[model samples]
Structure formats: C-alpha cells, structure tokens
Target: MYTRAEVYSPLQNTAIWLAAWLYSVESTDETVAALTDLGGRHSYGGQGLAALLLDARASADLSSHEPVVRLILWGPGQAAGLHAGSAAAEALGPAGAIVIKAAGGFSHVLVPRYWDDGVEWRWFEEKKRLPEPSWLSPGEADSLLSRATEQAAVLIEAAGGTRSDLPNPRLTVGTLADFYDTPGLPRGVTPRAAKVLARADRVAAIVETVTDRLGDHSYDPQLFALWRHIRTARMAGVADAVQDYRRASIS
Candidate 1:
C-alpha cells in the first residue's frame, strides 16, 4: 500500500497556494476551476473562493494589473513578514494572511477568521507603507528543512511513535489522510518547491497528530518542549516553502 504522503497533495497552507496561483496566472476558467477544487475543502461563509476573488477584483481593481501576492504565516511568538502594530499585522495576529499588492501601490491584506460555523475572509486595506517581507534564500530553506526533519524525529520519538487508537482523538490520522489526499499546487511550481512543500505538509501533519494524541497531557514540561520544537520546525518549513513557491512563480 502507498503511504499517505505519497497519495496526498501535501499542501497544508491553502491560502498561500491560492494567492501564489492567482499571482502567477490570469483569471481563466481553468483558474476558477482549480480554485473551486481547492476552496471546496474549506467551509466559507459566502460563495467561497469565487466570491472572495470577485470581491477582491471589484474592490481593488486587481484585474488591471497582475498583483504581487505574498503569504504571511504568523503565530503567537512569530510574525514573519508583517509589521508590528499595523492593522494588517494586528488583524492577522494568530491566523495567517495573504497580502495582495495591486497597481498604484494599493495593498490589500486578507486574513482568515475561524468561527464555530466556518471560516470567513476579512480584508484590511493597508494605507501606510507596509514593510517588505523578508524572504528566505535557497540555502536558508535547505537549513530550515534540515531542522524540521530533526524536530519531526524528536516529536515522533517523544510521542511514542504514531498511535492508531487514542481516546477522544480530536483529529484522527484517517481524517487527515483523506483531507490531504486532494489536488495540490498551481501551475509553474518548480519541482524543488513542490518537494519542499510536501515535506512541510508531512511535518505539520506529524505535529497535529502527535498533539491530538497528547490531548490534555500536552502541557507536560518535556512534552510541551517537544511540541514547541516540532511546531517551530513546521512553521519554518512552511515559510521556506512559501518563499520557494514565490521565487519559482516570479523567476
């Protein structure tokens, strides 16, 4: 039997992929179809990806020029590529962001708001000059991947390896397996970038799976440290993947 990673798309950050895809290509029927396929994975408030794209285009005049798209992945202690105290940065405190830079220096940042019902999109217009995102170089990306690999190993060892049965599991391995087994990547994504993204997705899945198993016991000092390590590693992998994807798209 094929491993879950082999069968799955390994694209965990959908917003990043979507933004990069939009930046790379024109809004054709194919683009819409691809968006629909990816957006269908999430539960949205309105008409989903189509509506979001339509609103963005209408409000920002995005069609006039191909906008620059940058993905921002933020957490409690980490806010890479975001200016502190800015509306866009504050709005995207924990959840990630997709920043679209249109003509005439118009910038629109889209942040996802998670509610009990579903996920919704929130747009914040950046009037002030936003700081340029600090992108990772190819070597930096490789270093990050190496760190992620080590962290993944540590997490797996600490979690006593993967468990098939856990009491009241929040996210089952099966569910994640199925969830990731979908279409991933946009056109023009380089093979290297795709590989990096796949590794990132695998590390992220490991983090989630192990965290679910720990449950309430995740607060244990040693376990918590291990969790933090894996989480940080996963974030690094994701950030590198995003940088690689952007580079591939632009180059």
Candidate 2:
C-alpha cells in the first residue's frame, strides 16, 4: 500500500499548488477547444482552472496524501472519456506536492501527476508534437500492455506501493464522457450555460490514448471506479455549459 503521505506529500501550500496546477493545463490550439469550457470565459482558461483547483484544495484542508480532488469536463453532456486531477496543498507541503490530470480516447486512458521540485509550472505548449500511445494495433496494444504492466510492477516496487493497485483499468466511451462534473468543483460554474456548449471531440481521442497508456500501469480498482463515476457525472454540468453556448450563439 502506498502511504497517504507518499501520494499527497507534494501539495502542502499555496505557492506550490499554484505552480503545480499551472503545469496541469493544455495550452496548445490542438487541444485548446476541448479544454476551453474548463473555466468558462475566465481570463486564463485551463491555466486559470489549475490555479483555482490549488486554491480550493488548500481551503479543503486535506493533507497532501489525503488530497482534495476535482473533476473537469468539456463537450456537450460530457460525451466521451473521463479524467481527474488531484491537488492537495494541505497534506504535502511545497517540495512534497502532487497535481494530477487525466483524459481517455481511442479506447485508451492516462492520468498524469506532477510532483513539485521547486520549478514554476509550465504548460506543454508544443504544437506539432503528438505522442503515439502504447496500443496502436491489436498486436501493438498487446505489446504495449505487456510493457506497461511490467513497468508498473517495477514502479510499484520502487515506490513501495502495491503493484496490484497501480494498473488502471481500460475506459469505455460513455464513462469517459462523464469525467468533467467533479464532486467538489471550484466556483464559477454556471449550470445554465453547459446546456448548449459545443466543442470538437478531438481531445477525446487524445485522452483515450493517454488513458490506455496509463491503464498499462497498476492502479487501485477503487480509484479506477471513481474515475468512471466522476467522468460520467461531468456531463450534467457539461449539458448546462452547452446550453449556455447555444444561447450565446443565438444572441
């Protein structure tokens, strides 16, 4: 078992959480539209959302190991893969922090975490670079899965976390769509707006590929189950966001 301290160690204060969250967003135009509704018309868009998550995570007062989490979503009614980010400034002070993000596509999945090393967080703004996930074809997916599982086992041994608890499960399309509506979302989400919002599902593919790669690692089943639930729930809020967009379009 990975101690709560290990998972939550890095996120212990405002500055670190803020910096870590900043590194959590997608700044490139390729993934831009998919992440736009993340913070509505907020000045910073996805970057702003990361900052906000850090602030709120601090307010919740959970230890970094016992992190406070949020679910983010885009698209109408949350149509496609689920993702999650965990930020906890309370448990893991500055040097020991953790910030996470995830999305699923191509029947694959990924969840990424950043452990602070005192560097100001920077978004990966690269434009023409796309990573090919582990599972490419039936043959390739199997090979990648084997590699991921083996790597997960090694990581588990190194971290002292259980190998069985690391390999995340495969994601389905419907569950992926519901990833946005988090149980503890930060302020400024307007329910009425998501009803008409529309965004290209291009990012859906990106997330799926990521999740698939992530699933190659070992993960707790409970965590995977939560990912599914939160992933699906975001649609309700997304529905509202969609409606907001439609009204704006009409106006």
Candidate 3:
C-alpha cells in the first residue's frame, strides 16, 4: 500500500483530481457478461476508459503523482454516479490513489490529505437501478470546485508546505478540454458527434451547438476555440502546440 507521504507530496497544490472511471461492471468480452452486463453504445465501450486508466496505472507520474484526494461514506445511499469494486481499489491501493464509490448524492467531496492507511470500499444494492452520473450544472460545478480548492489549500497549509512548493499537474489538451467542456461529455457529445467536430469546418458548428445547448448562460467562444485547439494538440502529442494554445488563452 502507498504511504500518505508518497501520495500527499505529489498532490500538494493541485486543485483538480486526476480521475478515471469504470462506468459499469459489464464486459463485452464474455467475463461476467450476464451477471453484470451494463449495456451501452458499442463504440463507447470499456476499451477507451480502460486504456486511459491503464496508462495512468502504469505511470506513477500520471496516476498517484498527480493531484488527487479521496473521501468515503459508509452505509446507505451508494447510488451516486460511477462506481467500482474492492478488486479495483486493491489494485490502486499500492499507488495511494483512492477509488471513490457509491455516494453520488451528498455533494462532490474533496478527499482529505491526512487519512489512515489502507483503501476503503462501498457497495450498492443489487436490485435498485441507479441513474448514471451526469455532469453538474455550471453553478453547481463551480461551487464544488471552489470548495475543493479551499480544502486543498488548507491541507497544504497544515502540512507546512507553501503553495509554491507544489506544481500544477501538466494536463493533456484532451483531458483539459474534457474539463473545460463540463456538463456535456460521455453524453452531450456522442462518439459520432465528436468525430464530426474533428474536422476544421465543423468547429464553428460544434461551438454553436454547445452554446445553444447552454441556453442563456454566459459563454466564451474564444475559450471554446482554445479548448478545441488544446484537444487537437494533446491528441497529436504536441507539447509546444499545447503550450501555444495555453498562452493564447491568457493573451
């Protein structure tokens, strides 16, 4: 198992969590096909989700070294959003990254810095069908992020570590774009629509589509453009391109 020091050191100043999810226990590959077969569009299968998690799992810098915190709740109301089992938690225990399960109801939680050894697990009732986790609205999401940032700052202070001591996790454009386009991923943009937006000409259309969907909320077209560029750069693995986009966002 990973020590608190190992996990906390890498996570110091970062507010965002480096997270991965297993949407369901179902497998198209035959194993547990009947017992836990959660169905979905074949294109958006476990392969992509698993690949992302596997990459992070293999690299400490991508996984545990990134900024993250874990919170747990025991007994009742385990129907919150996405979840995984003990086996998954055990697999990640050595890295000090926690698997948050069940509590999809009581607000988004920022896992505390100082916690005891060993990973904790929570399970849901088998009979009840729960709604898949969806992105929170802009206001709700912002509130959650604010609370999390404050909590992270306080944890850093208690550890006698200055904010400057910790570095922001260097996130890929794809990941950052996902964060930027909140309340509309894994659902809002279908795999098909995502492919359509891959073309240069479709950029404006996608932007317009998202803006329209957002209704009367204040929206920034430039930020959306920047996000699109960043996604392109990260997908292409061009660090300089990503940096250029980031610089452009502020300028």
TM-score: which candidate is best? 1
The TM-score obtained by model 2 is 0.21
Per-candidate Cα lDDT values, in order, are 0.51, 0.27, 0.26
Model 1, 87-136: lDDT tens per residue? Answer: 76766634466666666677788877655444567778876656764445
Q: Provide the TM-score for each candidate, comma-separated.
A: 0.63, 0.21, 0.21
Per-residue alpha-carbon lDDT of candidate 2 for residues 1-251, written as tens digits (9 for 90 to 100): 32122111111222222222333322333222323332223232245444534443334322222112222222222222232222221122212222222222111111223333222332221122123212122233233333443443344334332235433323332243344221122222243322211111112312332334234323444223222222222233233322332333335
Clashing pairs in 3: 70-111, 80-104
lDDT ranking, high to low: 1, 2, 3
Q: Which sequence of candidate numbers ranks them by TM-score, best first? A: 1, 2, 3
Clashes of 2: 61
Task: Report how far off residue 211 is in candidate 3 (Å).
Answer: 40
> Ten consecutive residues with minimal summed lDDT in candidate 3?
7-16
